[model samples]
Target: MEAKLDLPFDADKMLAGLQRWVECESPTHDAEAVNRMMAMAGRHLALMGATVETIPGRMGFGDCVRARFPHESREKGILVLAHLDTVHPVGTLAQGLPFKRVGDKAYGPGIQDMKGGTYLAVEAIGQLIKAGIPTSKPVTVLLTSDEEVGSPSTRDLIQAEAARHSVVLVPEPARPDGGVVTGRYAIARFNLRTTGRPSHAGARLGEGRSAIREMCKQIIAIEEMTTEACTFSVGLIHGGQWVNCVATHCDAEALSMAKRQEDLDAAVERMLSLKPTGNEVHLQVTRGVTRPVWEPDDKVLALHAQAEALAKRLGFALPHESSGGGSDGNFTGAMGIPTLDGLGIQGALAHTLQEHVQISSMVPRAKLFAGLLQNV
Candidate 1:
């Protein structure tokens, strides 16, 4: 086997860039905060000779940044997908989610989940350019701001760009065991509302149509829909106001995931087919974010084979897996384009306070990614 490729930057510089990203705190819902993070990343990309274009945000999200490294070739190239927004709020760092290193591990709210991945891609391109490696193909890097919230504003852009590229690479954080993802489950989010008549609990309790009571029954039914291939959960729910009066309204947010698109479609249809169980109570089910399952095809499998060979050349096993969490790769891979995902730094505990990444894995993972970029 050949020796491992050397990373362009050292660990200290890598950690410094990661610290800046984690400190920015670009939560999906906070447009201004996400925009600030975008600006920071755009400046870095600009210095690497990539032309940046800002895509204005819609539906109350931050603007997206697309950086392109143009080449002379007219053939299709690689599309690098990176999300700038994370699940952490603006004050998460100040609220005890400190960006610190402990014995070769870095802990922060968004560092492990994606900021680490984004910076890894950025540094990879910088290294490629600085090393005077001639571009084999055109490279486009898309940094969207709404991935944490399901990429509502940037899904179309992702699809359109993927259609033009030969391969799409998503730099979502690698698996806990240092594996890259080859497929993802389809995710469907629903907003459910139960509306009914309210009455005085003390005076006319029997006459009241309790929406909360009705929703509780529905929630149980939904929970029962979980199977080995499909899972459902009610993440958020709110109903009653005062103890004296009967509840008139109950709102809930439920999510479902399935490994197959057909199964997910059937499950969602059944959920929407729910009828009111309580007298005078009406149920409303509106679909929220829907991400299609990314199933591996022959092209995808071939890409994975190449990735595995490349990883072996660097003296490691590149295990590919099917993930329960969905990412933008689902969009492109499901669209029939050859796509490879989880090509980012190895980490775990994403989207949690305890989220962290192995500090020692940064350089090796970046070197692997850079090698793939040159070959794929």
Candidate 2:
């Protein structure tokens, strides 16, 4: 085996790499886009001297890429959680490229939301190779397809791998002040459906119980169940075949956030308990906790401490923080593993057209990650 040690990553090289990633538009739920990005990333990883494996495609164009700096044994491991899927649409890049670089800020669709974080992971590992430090633990960079939409299929894979590792690091972009996120709030998405008999407008209006009305009542009930401490939104609503006739059915999907499982269950219970009048209404709730809250557990804190020390070594401050945004780290943390987030290079206005990364953050953040991998 040949060991190469010229891992010094130049920011320019990283920039070019990022441009390639950014140029390969990947939307949150678009499977084909994700496949393209994975293919590109896989090739890059192979060139970096990693033994790469392309996880079978999930559903549509969705796929995951796993790469490891090959070692003799699977003794112990550290998993790096990253997502190649962005919030941008499939034609977003070509529609306008959105790629603008000024001074040190580079703006693009997935720049800050994630592609930047993914870039950091690659750059960091490259540094380790350059630094000539055999990885502390065999490292696996698990980049998935639909992180923005939640890892419905990949969650299991992430957790299973996380359970086997000593530490899990998530590059979920940085905080506003460029601090890495230490804690993550849990996310629960739900749907409510109501059914009522439709009747003629003026002829049998009273005979037909309005499902739409029942749905409204349920929506109000769900809304009242929320508080400042808890974030909830009944974002989608649909019903009514015709305005003249009574609505035979209604449905709404909502997003909820919680600090604990109890909080999540309580919210679900409330929605389920909602009883609609006018028509004997049926309320069905489909709830899923994509990423449960990772409230800084002791082991998690220790990991953060190591991360902070590593940042200090690189002349940067690792601001201790947590975020409401959900990531696969939450999945790892929920499984009782020490998970650390926000190791990515840049952060700001994520998931938007204004999304961008601080070009200056590239090298230092990579070094910070390398420090954690080598010394921690």
Best by lDDT: 1
- Candidate 1 regions off by >4 Å? 1-4, 201-207, 240-244
Highest TM-score model number:
1
* Model 2 misplacement above 4 A: 1-7, 59-61, 94-97, 196-217, 238-249, 280-282
Q: What number of backbone clashes does candidate 1 have, counting pairs of residues 3 or more apart or in separate chains? A: 0
* Residue 44 lDDT in candidate 2: 84
lDDT of 2 by residue, 1-376 (tens): 2223235868888888888888888886778878998999999888889899998866564889999887665777888889888877877766654787888889887988788878878878876765667776788888888777778878888887787788888888877787877678778887778888889987888878777888788777677777866667787899989988988888888888877767766766665566655436666777754567788888888888877876665677778787887888888877787888888866577766667888998888877777777644
